[model samples]
Structures are given as structure tokens and as C-alpha cells.
Target: MLTELHIRHFAIVKSLDIEFRNGMTAITGETGAGKSIALDALSLCLGSRADASLVRPGCDKAEITACFAVAKDSPAARWLAEQDLDAEDECVLRRIINKDGRSKAWINGSPVPLAQQKSLAPLLVNIHGQHEHQLLTRDEHQLHLLDQFARHNHLLEATKAHYRQWADTEKQYRQQQQAKADREAQRQLLEYQVGELDEFALAEGEFEQLEADHKRLSNHRSLDEASLFALNALYEGEHNNANGLVQSAGQRLQESVDMDPQLGSINELLKQAMVHIEEAALELRHYQDQMHIDSAELETIEQRMTQALKLAKKHQCSAAELYPLHQQLKSELQTLIATDEASEQLAEQRQTLRQAYREQAKKLFDSRQRAANQLSDKITSAMQQLNMPHGRFEISVDHDNQAPATAKGTDQVQFLVSANPGQPLQPISKVASGGELSRISLAIQVMSATQQTVPTMMFDEVDVGVSGPTAAVVGSMLRELGGQCQIICVTHLPQVAAKAHQQLQVAKHTDGKETQTDVRALNNDERVVELARLLGGDKVTDLTKANAKELLAS
Candidate 1:
């Protein structure tokens, strides 16, 4: 239940703090006196959209805080625990709206996204606005109300889940059917391309080796000439050959070694140089013997390289990538082959899901039928109390087996009513007058409230088109509802205001420079005065006061 509300700089409310108790509370004020200011503030804390105009004229920001007493096992408590924002059995929701229309929300002093507050709002408070009855004309709203009345959340969720799964599988099946021919064509093309690549069978690193051999063979003549010239110059040449010259220099250095020890080291270096030259000459002679000019081998390598380049270009890759591309195509072909088998499997799965969806939807349809009958009886009874003694109310739950499945199932729910005696039942939207609609809307709301698990319900002038004894009945109904949960109503009717266990009077005060709206809890005497004012308008007569007292005594 809501415990307290603290609002500052919101609308004409400069600052207000109000404590709430565990029964019906009526908020009353003159026209334009901002009777709904507290409701508006609470809405902001409950994650309603914010506007800069809601801030007081000269204030930088508007702030609203709402505190609730949460049962340990209530939905709000569980949600708070899940969000790691639990504060024992108390939950505080705060909202701050700046003049620029930017807003921030907090739960238990921890900042949170506005969406988080929105998600938690329904679990804490259920607000019925003045214009909520206008939505009753909509078919979707009617269906939603029926479902809420039914309270078969688990069955509805299961139906929705099955519908989604079936719909998804159906979509896949249709897409696969449409793409079957294209898939077959692709498979044939892949088979041909993969076959060609397999026949070529290029090994890894073979291209580079082939290129090296091709270069070597193409330059074999020049290589042979160079090696023969080097061999003769180093070892085979008899006149002034490198080996003969180095040997003569080493012998001269050895003869002078006895005269100078440094000359001995120079002679050893000359001997090492001569040995290196002789070994190099022998290597050159071996290379010259191994070198050959083979035109046929060169042509064969060239042809192979040409084919590799052609294949690489066709596949949009380099010659070295042909082997990898071939393996990738093979994998794709295998997957496409497996997809054919998967299509059959998916067909079977779709049939199974379709059957499952039908079963769940049927269960939901049956539940709606049962709930519709009970709700119709209750609303009809409530209508008689609201001054429509001859009114007949009924709920039509029609299930179409041939209709395509939807997340909400195949049930069409409509509210039918006959507001006058001898009138045939018709759709409420087409038959009920504005006043009748308001009362019917109120009856539905009352019924919905009883089924709600939330601890607090706020009605914002839902008694708009009701007056006389009907207004008193509405008030009494709200008071009775308060016995089960907290009820806060913003109303103008004195009958309604007098029925509340507590009354709050809203008054607008203005100076030359500023206007402010104030809300104060009304004591018994003050409540009498307020009720008298409501009864007699701006002038509170002695007769009106007496009547106010009489209304209160009832």
C-alpha cells in the first residue's frame, strides 16, 4: 500500500507532503484547483512521461517521491529483490524532471532507467485515469480486459510461445520451399566446379617450387657459361691462375718468417686463402657438370603454370590459393546436400509445432469462455446497483477454428449490453449512452481492481458522468474496495467525497507574482466545510452545511 507522497515544484504545487492510510481517500477541489496534482506526481514516480511544463513557473525542476509498504511475497517485493534494490519491506520510487524535459528515476536510492520504473509500476500501483473508459470502445482493449479478468497468465503465455514457435517454423518452411529450385541449381554448379578442382589436384607449396625450377632451366645456358669461366680462372687456368699466385705468395712469406714473426702470420693467411679458392673451383666444376638446357622440361613447367594461373583467375584468387578454395567449395557442397535433408526435418517440426499451438490456443479459448460468463454476470449485477435496474450485460467469446493463429489466440471477445428495458442486447460501443458507458466502465474497473494483486489503486475522476444516487453507489463501491486494498480517488461529487474514510482538499492560492496549489488532509470539521462547498458551489449556505453533515452521517 502507498504510505506517503512528497512532491515539490510540480505543476502549481510548490511543496506538498501527504500521508496515506489503509482505506479509501477522496481528493476534492474546485475546478482548476489542481485536484489531480497528487495523482500526477505519483504518476511521474511511477514512470509516466515527463514535461517541462509540469515544473513550477520559477522552479528549476520538479521532484516526486512515492513510498509503499511491500509484502514480502508481493510482486513488487520480488521485483525489487531481482533488481538488487530491495529495502526490506519498504519501496521508495522517486522521479526528478528538469525544466528541459529531461527526467531521472530512482528506486531505493539507486538510479535506474525510466523503463525499469515502468516495468515495476504495475506491480506497485494501478492508476485508472478519467478518460480510461474511452478505450472500452476498442476491440483490442476489450480482449485485453477479458484476459485480465480471466487471470490465466500462464495459459496465455504458453499459447503465445507456441504460436511464435509455429510461426517461425512456418516462415522457414515457406522460404525453403521457394528456394528449392535455386538450391538445386547451386548444388549442380558446385559439383562441376569441385570436380574440376579435384582433377587438377595442385599440392601445397608446389607452385613456388615449380616457379623456381622454371627460372633455373630458362637461364641454364648463361649459368653454364658463368660456371665454366669461374672454374678455369680459379683452378683450370695455367698462366697466373689464382691458386698458383696464392701459393707463390705463401712460399715467399714462409722464407721471411725467420726474419720477422709477423711475416709468418701473413704466410698462414695466404695458405688459407689458397685452400678456399681451390675448394670453390671444385664446386664450380660440379655445378657446370650438373647444369643442362632442356627445352621439353621448360615447356612442360610453363604449361603447368599457365593452367594454374588460368584456374586461379577463374576462381578470383591467386595460383597459391587454388587448393584452399577447392576445400572450401567441397565443404559448401556438403552443407547444401545436408540442407535438403534438413528441409524434410523442418517440415515435420512445423507440423508438430502447429499441433502444439492449436492445443494451447484451445485451452486458452476455453478459459476465456468460462471467465467471460462469470464477468458478464458480475457486471450485470453492478449495473443494476448503478441505477440501471433493467440493464443486461453479456460477454461474447467467439473462437474461430479456421482463423490463423495469433499470439493472443483465436478468441474474439466483445462486451454486449442493453441499457434499457425491452431493448435487445447490442455491442456496448454502439448502444450505451455516455453516462451508461461511464458506469459500465466503472463496473469493469471495479471488477478488474478486485482481481489485481497490486496494493494501491488510484481512480482519477472515473465518476465523471455519474451523480445523484449513482455517485453515492460509486463511492460506496470504492470504499468497499478499500477494505481489501488502498483506494485513492480524485472526485468532484460531494456524495463521493463524503463516503471516503479520509478527505483531502486542494486549494489554489495566488499572490501578484506567483500561484501555488496546496493539498491538506481534512479533519472532520474541515471535511464538512469542503463537502458543503462542493454541495453549494462557491457559496456555502447553512442548508448546504446541514446537507453535507447528513451525507457524512450516512
Candidate 2:
């Protein structure tokens, strides 16, 4: 319930602080006595769109703060917990709007976005007035009310989950099908790619080796000529060969060594030279053997190397990457095949989920239809008590053909009413006058209040169109509702005011040239006088006061 409200520099309200009590609290004053100002300030705290024009003429900013003490299990507290804000026995919402067209909001002194503040506002309070009659006028809201009345939140949640799954599956199925269809045009290219890569079958390190071998083989005749010339030079014909020359030198040195001691060192050096020349001659012969080249084998190597290069270019990769590319393509092909199976499986799962959703939706629709009827009947009865005795009301639950097959079991709910006897029942928005609609709106709210979980419900002049016995019944209904939840009503009806547990009289006082609104809680005597004023107008005669006292006593 709203515990307090503080407003500053907002519209006609310069500064005001009022503490509200539980149960029915009435705010009454003359038409322009700022009764609606208080409600407007409360609306500001609830995150309503702010305008710089709402600020006092001479002030830089306007501010409003509302304090609520909610039960631990109340939805407001639960909402606060979800927002990670302070939900401790009390919650405070504050909003400030600067003259520069900027606004800021806070929840429990913690800064928050306006949207979050708005979401939490409904949990704490419901301010129903002429504008909100649209809620009762809409079919979707009727369905929502029915769902709320039935407390089918768990089943509704299950339905939503099923919806999400069904939607996700449908999206996935479409995407996969589209992808498969698009891939059709690329199928020939993909297969050709796989086949071309497979044919080359290039081996690692083969390219570099082949290039070197090709160069050598391409100059095979020249290489043979060079090897033969080298061999001839190293171990030339018979007597001119390097080995024969070295042996001759060694034999001459050995004969000299027998004649002179210096010849001994010369003979050792000659023997070493002879050994090196013979080794060189053997290496030349080995080189000649290795130079043997076959033209046919060389052609085969060249052709394979050229094909490998061509395949690398066609695939936009190097020859070494061709093997890995083949593996990648094969793996992708395998995945495509597996996706076909998985898609079929998902389709089956989707069908199963769709069936479950259908069952749940049908159950939900049936429950709403029943709840709607009950709600309609209850509201109609209450409307008769509110003085529209001839008002005919109906809760129209019509089937909607435009609803998707997957929709929550195809029911479109609407509220219809007729304010006059024998008149055709029309949609609530069409058949009800403004004031008649006001009472009907109040009746609808009063009927739903017992089932709604909100802690506080405010009705701005709910008795606007009601009088006499109807006003008395409206007062009784409010009093009864106040016992269950906090109720605040702004009304000109003395009957309604007389039944309130507490009455806060709003009066305007002039300080010099400025008029300010002040709210005072009325005591028993004051309540009688205020009620008398509402009943008897400016002339609160002794008889009228006595009558007011009698009304209060009753």
C-alpha cells in the first residue's frame, strides 16, 4: 500500500507531503482543488512520461516520490527482487524532471531506467480512471483477466514455452530447407571439385623433388657429356691418365731416394699425391654411372608435376594442401547427409511439441471461456447495483479465423454492454456513455479486485456517475474491497465518502496572492462536516449536518 507521497514544484502543487493509510482513504474538494493533482504526482512517481511544462513556473525542476510498504509475498516485492532493487518491507520510487527536458528516475534510491520503473509500478498500484476503461474495452485484456482469475500461470507458462519451442523449430526447419535448396545449384560444382582434387593425388615434398629431377633430366645429354669429359681428364687415355702420371712420379722419387737422403721425404709426398688422384678417378666413374637418365621416365615425371600445379591453381590452394582439402570436402559431405537425418528427427520432434501445445492451448482456451463468463456475469450484477439496472452486459468469446493454427486454441474474447433496455448489445467502447462507462469500468474493476494480486487500487472518482442508493452500494463495495487491499477513492459522492475508514479533505488556502492545496485527515466531527458539504453543498445547514451524522453512524 502507498504509505506516503511527496511532491514539489509540479503543476499547481508547490510542495506537499501526505501520508496515506491502509483501507479506503477519500480525497474530496472542489472541482479545481487539486484532487487530481495528487493523483498526477503519484503517476509521475510511477514512471509516467515527464514534461518540462509540468514544472512550476519559477522552479528549475519538478520532483515526486511515492513510498509503499508491501507485504513480503506481494507481487511488488517480488518484482523488486527481480530487479535487484531494495524490496525490504518498503519501496520508494522517485522521479525528477528538469526544466531542460531531461528526466531521471530511481527505485529505492537506486537509479533505474524508466521502463523498469514502469514495470514495477503496476505491481504496487493500479490507477484506473477514464483512460484505463480501454483495458476493459479490449478483448486481449479480457483474456488476460480470465487467465489471471483462473490463476493458470503455470499452464500459461508451459504454453509459452511450447510456443517458443515450436517457433524455434519452425525457423530452423525453414532455414535448413532453404539452405539445402540453395545448395542444389552448387552440387555439380562441389562434386567436380571433389573429383578434380582426388585425381591429382599429389604427394607431400614430391613437387620440390620433381622440379630438381626435371632440371637434371632436361639437361641429360649435356650432363653425360660433362661426366665423360671429367672422367677422361682425371684418368685420361692410358699413359696420360692422372693415376699413371702419379705412379710414374712415385717410382722416379723412390729410385732417387736410394741415391740421396733428401729423396726419402720427396718419395712420401709423391705417394700421397698418387692416392688422391686414384680416389678422384673412382669418384668420376661413380658420377658417370649416376648420370644414366631415361627419357620416358622423365616425361612421366614432368607430366605429373604439371598436372599437380594445374590442380593447385584450380582449387585456389597449394599442391601440398590438396590432400587436406579432399578430407575437408568429404567431411562436409558426410555432415550434409547427417543433417538430412537430423532434420527429419527435428521435424518429428516439432510435430510432437505442436501436439502437446494444442492440448494445452485447448485446455487454456476452455478455462478462459468459463472464467470470462463468470467475470461478465459478476460485472453485470455489480453494474446493476451501480444504478444501471437495465444495462445488459455480455462477454463475447468468438472464434477467430485469422489466428494461426499454432495459436493458443483460437478464441477471441470481447466485452459488450448495452446501457438501455431493449437496445442491442454493442462493444463496450460503442454502447456506453462516458459516465455510464465509468460506473461499468468501476464494476469491472471491483469484480476483479478480489482476484487481482496488486496491493493498492486507486479509483479516480469511481462514483462520478452514481448517486442515491447506487452510490451507497458503490461505497459498500469499496469498503468491502478496502478490507482486503488498500483502496483510495476520489469522489464527490457523500455516500462513498461517508463509508471510508479515513477521509482526507483537500482544501485550498491563500497565502498572500498564491493559492496552495493542503490535505488534512478529518476526525469524526470533521468527517461529518465534509460529508455534509458533499451532500448539502455550500449551505451545510444544521439539518444537513444531522443528516450527514446519521449517514456516518449508519
Number of the top-ranking candidate, with lDDT as the measure: 1
Per-residue accuracy of model 1 over 321-365 as CA lDDT, tens digit each: 888898999999999999999999999999999989988999999
TM-scores of the candidates are 0.79, 0.83
Lowest-sum lDDT 10-residue window in model 2: 400-409
Q: For residues 1-554, could you state the per-residue lDDT of candidate 2 as single tens digits?
A: 99999999887678899999999988888777878788888998888888889988789999999999978887788888887996689999999999987999999999999999889888898887745576776767777666666667777777787877878888898887878776655555667777776676665577778888999999989988887877786676555776677778888878787679798888888788877877887887888878777989899988988888788787898876766777788677667667778888988988897777777777777777777788888888998888888887778776543467544456777788888888888888785378888788778878877787788988888666678888889899999999998999988989888889999988877778777777779899999898889888988989889989988987
Local distance difference test, per candidate? 0.92, 0.82
Where model 1 places Cα greater than 4 Å from the true spot, the runs are: 193-326
The most accurate candidate by TM-score is 2
Candidate 2 local Cα displacement, residue 80, angstroms? 3.1
Scored against the true structure, residue 144 in model 2 reaches a CA lDDT of 69
Clashes of 2: 0
